[model samples]
Structures are given as C-alpha cells and as structure tokens.
Target: MYADVTVVGAGPVGLVLAAELALSGVTVQVLERLAEPETSMKAGGINVPTAEALDRRGLLPAAERVHRETMERMGAAFGRKAGAGAGAAATPSDGRGAGAQRQMTGHFAGMVIDAGLVDWDDPDLAAHAAVAGARMVPQRELEGLLATHVERLGVPVRRGVEVTGFEDTGDGVLVSTTAGAIRTGWLVGCDGGHSTVRRLAGIDFPGTDAELTGRVAVVDMADSSVLDEGWVWSSRGAYRRGPQPGRVFTVEFDAARRDDAENAGTRPHRGAPAEPVTLEEMQASLRRVSGTDVTLTALHGAATRWSDNTRQAATYRSGRVLLAGDAAHVHSPFGGQGLNLGVGDAMNLGWKLGAVVAGWAPEGLLDTYDTERRPLGAWVLDWTRAQAGVMRGDAKSVALREIVAELLATRSGATYAVKKISGVTQRVEVPGDHPLAGRHAPDIRLADGSRLANHSHAGGFMLLDRTPDGAFARAAATWAGRVRSVPDGTDAAGAARAEPAGVLVRPDGVVAWAADEAEATPTAVTALEAALHRWAGAPAHEPVA
Candidate 1:
C-alpha cells in the first residue's frame, strides 16, 4: 500500500517510532518480514524517561502488563513473598517501623522487596514529574502492543513484507518490497543495524568491533521456578547477579577460558544455535559459579559481542527518506539503553514529522534529527563501551566491577545507577541558563489535589504554575493548541513549605524554567519562549505562529 512514510521492522524500536508517528497524526506504514511478533521474552528492562514518554502518549498500561508478569516470575524464583506491598511499602530510615522492610516467608523465605520491584506510578499522573519511574516489558511484548496501537491509530502495518530496495526522488520516495511497490513522501528506516535502506542510500557506517567479546544466549525459560535471579558468571569466579524472578534472568556467556594466551581471533556467532542449553548445563554453571543450582527453561539466544559502530548516517535525511533506531546508531547494550534510546528518537522525530506532514514545519527542520541524535548516540556508545569493559571479569575489570556494583546496590548507588542507566542523568542540550533548564520537575500536588505533570504530549512547551492573570492561556492560543498552561500550586495554608510558585516544563516533561510568582512573569517567560523556539527551530523572538 502507498503511504506518507514506510517503517521497516516491527521490533520495539520500529513499533515505537510508528506509534509516535501515528499518535502525532502522521500517515505512516510499518513493514515487517516476520509473520508474527516474537513470543520470546527479550529486553531485560526499561529506564525512567522511556516510561514517562510512553505514558505521555497513553501506552503505559499495556507496557506495565509485561513488566508486571515478568517481575512476578522473578519474585517467585528469588524466594520472595508475593504482594503489592513488595515495592509500595515505604521503608523507614532506621530500618525498623511500619514502613520498614517486609520479610519473605513460606515457599519463599527471607527475601525482601524494594523499590526495584514496583512498576512505575500511573503515567497519567506521574510521567511529567522527574523522568517518572521505570517499568520493564520484554521487547517483543512491547512491540506487539505498540504495533496494535499504531494500527488502531489508522497507520497501516503490513506483515511478512520486507523492503528490497528504495529510491529517493526528491519530492517523494519509491520503495520496492516483498509485498509490492509503493510510493511515499517520506521513508524511515527502522529496519536495524544491517539496514538495506541505509545501504541503498550509500551511507557509510563507521565504528570498530569490541575486542575479545563473544555471543551469549538471551534465553528464557518456560518456567523459572528453579532459577533465582539473573546472573552473569565467568571462569574467573566473578558474576553479576540479576533481580529475583517475575523479573528478568540473564545468562551472559562472557566466559573466559583457562588459557587466555590460547584465545583466537574467531568468535561464536557463526556457530549453529546450540540446542536450547540443557537444564543440567545451567544448574552446573550456577553451582560451579555462584554455589547455586538453578534449573532453567531456555528462551532465546543473541550475540552480545560489543559491536560499537557508533555512527548515525552522515545524514538523517536523504531527500524525503530518513533513518531511525539502529539504522542510525548501534551501540553496546551496557545500561539497557538501546530500547530507551530508540524510543526517545521516535519522540523527537514524531513531532517534526507531524508538523511537516501537517504543513506547518519550516524547511530544513527535519535536518535537526541527525544534529540532535548523533551526539546522543555517540555518548551512549562511549559510556556503554566503558561499562562493558568493566564487566569483563578480567583481574582489573573484576576489581572495578566489585567497587562499582557495591555502590550500585546501595540506596544511593541504586539511585545513581538508575539515573545513568535510564538516561535521566544525561540532559538534552536545550538553549538556556534557566534554573529549570535540563532537569525534570519533581511531582507536585496542587492545593486542589491534582498533579501538575500528567499525560501531556511532548510536542510543545507548557507553562505550569499558580497565576490567574493567565499569560499561559494567552500563549496557548497563539500556538494553536500546541502550547499548554496549567496553574498548579498549594493554597496559602499549604504554601508555607511548598516549592517555588511557578515552573515552565518542556513537552518532554523536563522543567525548562522555574521561579516564584514574582520572577515568573518575565524571566521565566523569556526562558520558556526561548526553549520553544529552540526545539521548534525558530527565532527566539518569532511569533508562536
């Protein structure tokens, strides 16, 4: 079928791209070579910002189901008691109180559940505040949900069809696929790292392979009753542990041989998939390593070798055709950052694509896609490369891992690690020096008991605070519904200990400018308007139109 845009691959990245585009009212099509989405559970977890982004567009419920189900399995295997109280109960600082930690009992004994187990807060009320909380959903399940939503949004998806070739003809793109030939105004290659569209565009992918890294099975078990948590063990007697089951369990094959000097240049990907690794193999490996014998149900296998081709296309646009997801950048999966990165890419591109299709975006606006995303990709690649090296289990790497992982396990460490892994710590380079610049706002309850941040679209700048004169209302009108304003704060009685009075938040829910009422009228307005123009690619003083 012919359409405005055709996206290849219905994987998480591609589906997310499609859903964002469709939700933004772009006419798009998704093509997948697979007859059906994989049932194999993959993608161990997601980060905070991604959860917020998905929730902003109303897709969190479906996403949470997958995380909830997986975490349940993890809890059982880890010998943990089951209850919603697992993560909901607040722990007292003294470590003893009603809010203190709950203990595991019965079939599961002595296990404790913490913030790590909870699904994120309801997206409707929580997404706009401080990057929100992270929720885990297997990649396949996430993809299926997004694909369904995209189709529901009226964007057509053609399965079992692969694109063989495409030609960019300036005004539009002509695509040839297994299904047939079609023409479109825009073509997006969400296909993957080994993308045909990228190749056809004659773009070069530049980067180097990580040294001595090899493939590992990304296996899943039909039943995880015997397994406790995800663990990574090496011959050096070092392994990284995973969370309890109902959560994800990963078996990394970064096994080191007894004789490093005997190591060869060849790695294992070319080998035929080993018969689902036998239960005995898993039990033996666990016992030999962690002194734990856990039977496993094999799920799927993948190459985890570091393939760090940290490059976006020399350009994101080639006439009407563009690239997104792995087609644009493929890096090591150090922080479970791949899926989250792809989702953000979709969010950034969605609004621009929508504006272009809706006939409001200025010429050259889409070019910013590469300018903004490429550096982000490079940063992730570099950070992950360092992370992978630290996980190597070599003598020095193991020492570093011990120090780092210890820090990661504590409350402070968890917070620090989560922020980095979730992409929350890396602020986007928006143009401004406002107090709220490049930071997420904390969730605040208004005097009326409503949250200031909720399921708002990440397409326009929004001002949220407590002022009746309503400069926000006026600005909202000038932008034709793209800009939104909300008056949110406590009443006088509640204001004694409340935060500052006014805040301007970006479409992505990050606070762009914040101030008390006295400073809100001018300084904050200037900053908010400046952020709008920066993201919208217009002059700071230009009219909202």
Candidate 2:
C-alpha cells in the first residue's frame, strides 16, 4: 500500500499528526504495535498550548467532556465531592479564591504553582485570556478521542502492525513491518522513547543519565492512613498521596548508586525495566520513600516506572524519515511537560511536512520544523533536569527547594512560572519586529462576532485584515488558494489593544506577519506579499474562486 505519510505509533501525538496531515489533504495512516490501547496512567493533564491546539481543531469540546467524565470517576473513587483534592489548593494570600486555583496549570518538581497568583493582566499573558486553560485528561482518553477524530478524517489505524524496520529512499520510504511492507512519501516516528524507527534511522539521542527512579500505581492498601494526603519530601525521597484514591507515587534517589554498582562507570539504565512491577516491589518502594509500611494488597492495572533521564534528538529529520513526540525527546514526567512538548512538535511539524508532500512548501520550509522545535525540546530537557535537581533528597536540594518555594509564592515568580508551564510564553523565531509576530495569535473576535479560532478549524493559513478598505486582503489575493482572507471586519477589541491593522496567521496559529498602521500602505502591502511568498510559497497562477 502507498500513503503520503505513515505514522508509527497510535498515541495522542501520532493521532494528532495524522489528523493534521489529513486535514491538509495528505493521505495518512497510523500503525500501532499493540492490538489495544494500554490502560497505564500517563500525563494526567495537558498544558495551555496543547489545549489551544485542540481548540483550533474543534477537538477541545470532546476532550473537555472526557476530562469531566474522568474527574467524576476519580471523585467517586475518592468518595469526595467532585473535583475535590484533584490539584493544588489556592494560597489565602493570592486572593483569587477557589475558582482560579482549580485550573492547575503545572508544578515544578512536586511544588504545585498556584494559578491564583498568575498575573493575567500582564500584557505578555493577554493572549491566553481568550483561550481555555489547562485541563486534566488522562493519556488513554485523549488517545481515544484523537483516534475517533482520525478515523472520521478517513485515516486508517492498523493495529498489531509493528514497524520492524524501514529504508528512506531519496523520494519515499519503504517500511517493513510484522504485518507486511508499505511504501510512503514520509515516515514519522511518534513512538515512545526507545523508538524502533529512530534507532533504524540512526538518529543521535544524546543527553543525561538517570538520577532517580519513580513508580506510580493504583493499589488497594490494607492501611492507607499512614501516608500523607499530598506530596511529602523526606530524607530518603518523596511520595504523593491521592489525586485519586488508591493512586500512589514514590520516587527514590538511588539511581546513581545502583548505576555505580551495575555499570561500574558507564551510563545508568536510561529507561524502565522490561519486567513487570510486582506487588512486593511496590510495597518496598512505598516503604522506602514514605517511611511507612503501607501494605499493597493488589495492583489495579499495570504499574509504570520512570526516571529523570532527559534526552533530545540531535535533529528531528533524516531524508524521508522524521521524528515527533516522545520519539524526538524524553524526560521525567515532572511539570507534565512530556506530552505537551510532543503535541507541540506535532503541531509545528505537521503542517510543514504536509506542505512538503503537497508540493507547495517553500525552500527550506521543512528545516524550520527542527530550527523552531528542537530548541523548545532542549529547553524542556533542561527544565525537567532542573526539577530533578531540586527534587533530590540531598540537603542541598532541600535548601534549593525551599528557595524555589519562596519564589513561587510571589506574584512575579508565579506569573513567570505559570507562563513557562502553560506554554503561553513560547515564541517562534520568525523574522518580524511586531509584538505579535512569531507568537501564537490571540483569539481575536472579528466584527461578525466570530473568533479567530473559528476560522482556523480548516487547517490553513489566514490573513485577518482589519484595514478599513480591505487593503491587506486585496494584496494577499495572489496566494488566496493557500491562505484564507477574512476582510471587511474590524477586530472587536483590537482597537482597544492597539493591535495591528492586518495579521497573517499560520495553520498552527502562529503570527507570521503583522501591520501596525491603521491602513495598509504600499510598503506594508509589499511586506505582506513577501511574507506570503516566504510562508505560503509562490502565489497560485490563478486566483482561487
């Protein structure tokens, strides 16, 4: 069989990438090694950037419904009011009340950053005000949601088809799987860390060794009262009580010691072991971290192991072969950055790769995917590494945690942390001096009352023209086939904020160019024309009907 793109791994990232590619008129298929989706718990929530991406695709409502159902299940399991004790509580000093803290933006190490302290009034943060905040949707539910969406888009997801190998020909890729072989124009590895596709493609994944080992599981305990209700740091390590009843997490900082004994001097084991985690092992780890003999009667599902073994690929692409999601980078689950980072990679790369396959990509367009996303991946690696350092059981780390806690309590510090954790502060390095340039476009409300997000559901570039005479829209006509123009309407609140007269927004919601003047001058129109060529490629020979 032949396809435009063959995505290896049917997880959320792969599914989202498949949907994006299909929306861009590219034929895509997804392959999964597992016959059924795993029920293991991962990424209990998604951050702000991921939430906005879902919203852009009209998938947020379904995701929100799933999140509500998950919360209700947890509430019933905990035998408490719905949504109680699910996330960090608001500090009395911040004074935004219970409503604000419920958003649960993110945490550094185990220190939960209270959402109440975030300065929404900050000009830098204004973009997020229109978009939804973070939501608590487990990984499995998200995968299911995206799977349905991808199927509706007419993309087939073949199960039990393990991609054993592949060769990237100059023009296409020939994939060898357990089921059979298939040829495709492009191959993307959205598989988890230890990806077969990455290994086969010979991409370099270089980074730090593991520092601590952590285990999370849902267990029935004979006496659960011994453990604290939230995260507790001790001299040995740290442990967390319920975000859901019977859900326990423990981390032990003995990785270096274990590595020294096992590897002698080489690198420590980079990921979790292949063997299943036994009941005895869970009890022992709980005892070591909590200093309490909590007897685990039984494990409900599979127990998973993780570590702070952060790493990123040297590059994201190799000929017809490329990488996204966990296949591109790996780190500890701290700050809940892994899934969000992967989703961002897919959003940034999907449209570019689709353009490449569709024969309209500008020169060096696919290269920008690496230039824009690799640094973000590198930042996340260091971000998780920093959290790992602060989470160490040593006295120095404890002192450092104390300082970080103090900083987290202040307004400036909380705002900065929330900005980073929510991903609102991340900006692409696209060339432009406008404040909104290279940044995620704010969901501006047009005069017709339709928001910018309403126009982005089709997965195409947009020229939001607020010019009184539709000057910018007229200038962008040459690229009308590739870019949709919304003219003859003013931004409902753009005037108040002194927003640009016209702005060019990419398929992924990034602002490519903007005109600050109230009217589009000859010079401004020329710049807009140049941006269209740079991002949308050469204008179509005939204007789109």
lDDT per residue for candidate 1 within 252-342, as digits (tens), equals 3343322112111122211112233444454454445555544445524432322322444567767777777777766555456677777
Each candidate: what lDDT? 0.55, 0.78
Residue lDDT tens for model 2, 232-297: 999899998777668888888886433221121111111323456678988999999888878889
Best by lDDT: 2
For model 1, the superposed segments whose C-alpha errors exceed 4 Å read: 83-134, 212-232, 236-314, 362-364, 402-414, 440-444, 453-461, 489-507, 510-520, 536-545
For candidate 2, the 10 contiguous residues with the lowest summed lDDT are 261-270
Error of 1 at 6 (Å): 1.9
Least accurate 10 contiguous residues by lDDT in model 1: 101-110
